[model samples]
Target: MRTAICDMLGIELPLLAFSHCRDVVAAVTNAGGFGVLGAVTHTPEQLEHELAWIDEQVGGKPYGVDIIVPEKYEGQGEALSLDDLAARIPPEHHAFVDRLLREHGIDTTDRAELAGRGMNISDRIGERLLDVVFRHPVKLVANALGVPPRYMIDRARAEGVSVAALVGAKEHALRQVEAGVDILVAQGTEAGGHCGEVTTMVLVPEVVEAVKDVREVPVLAAGGIVTGRQMAAAIALGAAGAWTGSVWLTTEEAETAPYTVRKMVAATSRDTVRSRGRTGKPSRQLASAWTRAWDGPDSPGTLPLPLQSLVSEPALRHLDTLAEKGDRGAQELATYWVGQGVGLMNRVRPAKDVVYEIAEDFAEAAERLTGAIGD
Candidate 1:
């Protein structure tokens, strides 16, 4: 449908797909839906190459970028490099993770070798990413965790790109609008990745009313929104559009781990849990041994932000590698970020097809609503 987001972003539909796969992003954009690439883990060099590749594929079609810039995290403001952040990770946390893996039948002998740079949530990396973003034909940029930084907002403004931010609470939405965010994605606990406790059904309307007097900004409903009918429902809740992620994880073009994708396809809405085991912040993911161990009695507990990733990424990466090789223990521990809508995503489809399906569903739902009204 023609909503404010469609007009603002020069797209035919107000559907914004948040995906890490460049293929999915380009496909969605070409299908008349906006695609926002998640770059929290990408280096500047990597993001530049991705945006360049998307530029070639979309042929001037508008797309967006998502970066994590949490307001608070371990070693935040201390000029900590990735190495520094890793060093800050307590030995107890490392030992706990190793023991947890060992208990699950995973070999932890090469634990050091499995280490990888986790998410780039610091200003140092974010500033560099912004430089790469402006260097491409990116249409919008969003801070996945908190308010967009001054440099990010300024650079986007100078380049005429719209700025968006994801918020879980009404207060956060108000703060984002006051910070000059062009759009607000009211993400609820049902969403993947880091999220708050509110449900989307309640959060969207709360956010819409909270920011109405502060400024005129389109609110996009996110969390458990995987179909066109859900987008129509979001619009009914005062959202100008819908911001979706989990549904695309099952798409043919997705970068989700093979085993995890299979798990997602078979998962029910109740199978997901908001566990802080991965990111040190409550993020919705499939309930697995990894999450359970972290919440167990013998756990060292999760660390803050980037530091927690240090504890999780290496082990999770190892689990994924082994799970693909048919290790039962690894498979049981392997989980990925996904929303409760995994229940509705039963099949893998092409990204373009998914976009069109959503559009058609939205139309049918809208028409049904129109006909229901007593004329």
Candidate 2:
């Protein structure tokens, strides 16, 4: 627990739990680990309200925020709203989605009404989220998709808030370090959302070696890292901590869609597949009919970032609802972004209990390693 990440975040444990649920965030923080709230989906006003609620619950424990500001996304600077993006989605793609849904015996009626109701990815929106975060007492801010924007880096530095960024490769980590990120989340392809095809064991040390001297930023090994021994391995390879997301989805307080959580609990490491059906980027999700469609040869290629997300958002929402109703095909296509670590997550536990479990595993692993050296 005396790792650099613990020192940097002012937490007793270096385990970082990322969740969209306020209860999960507060519980992890109060349990002596850092909890980072995913802020990409929340509007600025909603984030402000959620952060305020978290502040009241955690009683001043340190926490962080994560936003998805993809360095290269559709409508990057166009100032497009969700409606604008929805309009840009080609009619061909829409037709294809409709055909697929109906062919699979799923409903498509709600897709039209929900078309443009979600968050629109843009530099402006990300900056707005940053402004809301800076107004509060956040300890850290992370860019989930790419290097922290220069403006974000400048703002966080000015406010003394540490900035972290996720990278899927060694080169990406170097880019983040050069851009002034305070921490490197070396995420592997096995990660759930918008990831590249590199396993954690290979990616972590590669990133550590790439940035250790050029920048002394702490590296957190992520992707398929589910157990304390895995976290220990990352530390032994020079990482400062572990960045985890999927393991927290099953936590009692997680805000993951209910049906998706049920599927996650029953999933195996092999149950996931990487496809561009969700966010227009290759993200790992539970293998389902949805991913299978994109992976199939007869399917049309995926659209770019926001465009693809726009086209699929309604379908995904409907799938979840229908899947919960025992619709077999909907359930077959019902999945969410989660890492390969699903196999290790068997039961639902409290967020606080998860924090303790990680700490206990880390301690036990360290003790065993030390004893082995003595032996």
Best by lDDT: 1
Q: Where is the poorest 10-residue window by lDDT in model 2?
A: 111-120
lDDT of 1 by residue, 33-85 (tens): 99999999899999989999999999999999998877888887888778878
User: In model 1, which range of ten residues has the least summed lDDT?
Assistant: 110-119
C-alpha lDDT score of every prediction, in listed order: 0.91, 0.85
TM-score of each: 0.98, 0.96
**Which pairs of residues have clashing backbones in candidate 2?**
none
Candidate 1 to truth, TM: 0.98
Off by over 4 Å in 1: none
Report clashes for each candidate as comma-separated counts.
Answer: 0, 0
Runs of candidate 2 with Cα error greater than 4 angstroms are 110-119
Q: What is the lDDT of residue 249 in candidate 1?
A: 97
Per-residue lDDT of 125-174 in model 2, one digit per residue for the tens? 88899889998889999886777678999999999999999999888888
Give me the displacement of residue 116 in model 2, in angstroms.
4.5
